[model samples]
Target: MDNLAAEQATDWRIDWQAPWLAALRELGQQAHGLVQAGATVASGLQYVKQAHGLLPGWQFVDQQQLPVGQAYEAFICNQRCIPTRNNLHDFFNGLIWLHWPNLKQQLNALQAGEIESQGVGAQRGRLRDSITVLDENGGLLLAPQALCDALREKRWQDLFVHQRELWAQAQFLPIGHALLEKLVQPRKAITAHVICVPMVQAPAMCTVEAADAWLSEQLRSASCNLVNKPYLPIPVLGIPGWCLQNQNFSFYDDSLVFRASRTA
Candidate 1:
């Protein structure tokens, strides 16, 4: 069997109750229910499009629908359909599109614009590479300046332990579909390239829709700086309340996963 078919045959399960998946539980459960009913990724996404009334007229189409020699982003931009495979990767991608349509649209536009300026070259160039990284493994970190500073500086102990209570005031949303897929089988080394959102007020007060809107604006304003990969590597499990292993103070002692900041 081909890779896609093999992947479809695999029994895929998502524990929505998992602490790591708490942030995405609502949407995850919806998608999980559809998949459990034996819906393919494209079909499930089509259902979501109808139910949620997804904007920009984006629809999920089979990967085969994507023409040969056509870039995925460019195709989505021109055709208004996302090429999806029947796998966990595309399943989570569909869920993200439902939750953050504006962000997904913006990312696609940036990618398509890049491809237009510079044809599908062997090298994707800096902007395209950065955009891909964000789409695949990014996180949105809405926290106070202090917590953000601690994280950006690689002060794991300060950010995850000392300021543990502060986490209640913050919100960290996993924006990358690949990151969500990886968390299905929780691992200690699972990290996210967290983009810090500038918000002094407690993020817990902001609704999911409000947070999504704020994040979309932030990304739009900083599209250029993305080329520099201005993101902090965060060991997601270390976040307080996300994992049982991290409850102990010694969890941050692993230098391999939570490495110290490099010298200038």
Candidate 2:
């Protein structure tokens, strides 16, 4: 299915008892207003560029205020993105900008470079396509290198079973509703583009406060290359404690939200 059809099919409707649900709902409400106002996804992006809020290293600006050029090229050049009432696609894009502006800018930079070099084509190549796919429907895990190593290697006992404390130190920020939806009924496709942020400072024992603090720090720290080249995506189900439906430390394993990446 295309982006819009899939978005229509998606349950962007959040009914969570999560701590971060308020923020998610706030963004949803903002984007929902546009949709309710009879906005189409594509045109909806054009409408919300009226802000001047400073987010980390970037500032929100209208595309009309930017230099004249191809639409995508102009957006990239100005280091800007739009929020659309259009489908969950751009709405989620806007949500990401609200939640993680620095990363959104980074992704836009990469996309701009592609458009600049490739003459703003109607289509995208693998790198650009992969990046777009990732932005639209990716989940991110932020943890130190060692914890990541164990998770990647499926060292479940060491990571979640024996030393469960190590597993809690990480952050799970799902990028797309589709990713979360897929978690309810997981398919390999939903597991396709997992993004990792290597935070050496993350504590061994993850607390809600520490995770929040670390994410805040990441948000402020000047943009970094959050993903690697060729994008080594991880299996969403394979997140150590995430899919292990058994006794010992079953908070994640037994939870219905196995696919829910808690992106605060």
Candidate 3:
């Protein structure tokens, strides 16, 4: 495809108004402008950096700027710049950096520390693997105690239908860049490794900045060992009001998508 055609094609893939993008709506709109203007990923990063006033030292450079042998995380830590590509994956990644700089920085630090101490071995080790999962396909679920319990137990009917009203007081922020890319063409089985953050009351009053702060703090704490993957499997599209088809009570009946929990 021609350059303009390819850009337009990519632009259409992103529904800026999608419910999953609610938290990122403003940044998404600004980034869409860069896409519409035909700015390359590297240049787009510069625009967002200046417009949004991102981290002082960090910048986005072309993927080619990455050396042949250096690890990606190592490069980011040593050089303070991200090796970005011209694709949706990198695009969403940049948006994540814009929205959650602290969380991204924390993950990068953990990864780099692992590489520094362990070297890039055949296996990424538990903490590094967990960090990768969070960076690529993680989510933050803010909900009441009951809602969190329903999700942990895989109680689809109770989570989505029986206690549907509870969703109004809850929020699910998609943190993984790969997850955001996949959501561009949403599917029934698109699940998120959700870290449940139980709230005393509804999180309706919470702000994006507040959420970012809280999540960053959690990752920085000593208990950040994610080896066991302390995340719940939540089929994101099934969240009430996220997908039009899910409005029907029977939407959760598909065992294929909402599988029952495995027993010991």
- Which prediction has the highest TM-score against the true structure? 3
What is the total number of backbone clashes in candidate 1?
A: 0
Report the C-alpha lDDT of model 3 over 214-234, residue by residue, as the tens digit: 777767885555778778889
Report the lDDT tens digits of candidate 1 across residue range 120-206: 899999988988888999977889788998988888889988888888878788888999899888899999998886575434436
lDDT score at residue 131, model 1, on the 0-100 scale: 83
lDDT of 2 by residue, 1-264 (tens): 246644563544544433223345554555555555555543433344333242444433333445455565346446544523334544555555666554566566767776778866767776677666667666566776776665555454455556656556666666654554454454433354554656664444244334334544553462333433333455555455454433345543533433333431
Q: Whose lDDT is higher: candidate 2's or candidate 3's?
A: 3
Q: Which candidate leads the pack in lDDT?
A: 3
Q: Model 3 reaches what TM-score against the true structure?
A: 0.93
Model with the higher TM-score, candidate 1 or 3: 3
Instruction: Give model 2's TM-score versus the native structure.
Output: 0.56
Where model 3 places Cα greater than 4 Å from the true spot, the runs are 1-12, 201-205
TM-scores for candidates 1 onward, in order: 0.91, 0.56, 0.93
Locate the minimum summed-lDDT window of 10 residues in model 3. Answer: 1-10
Which residue pairs clash in candidate 2?
A: 41-86
Q: What local lDDT does model 3 show for residue 77?
A: 90
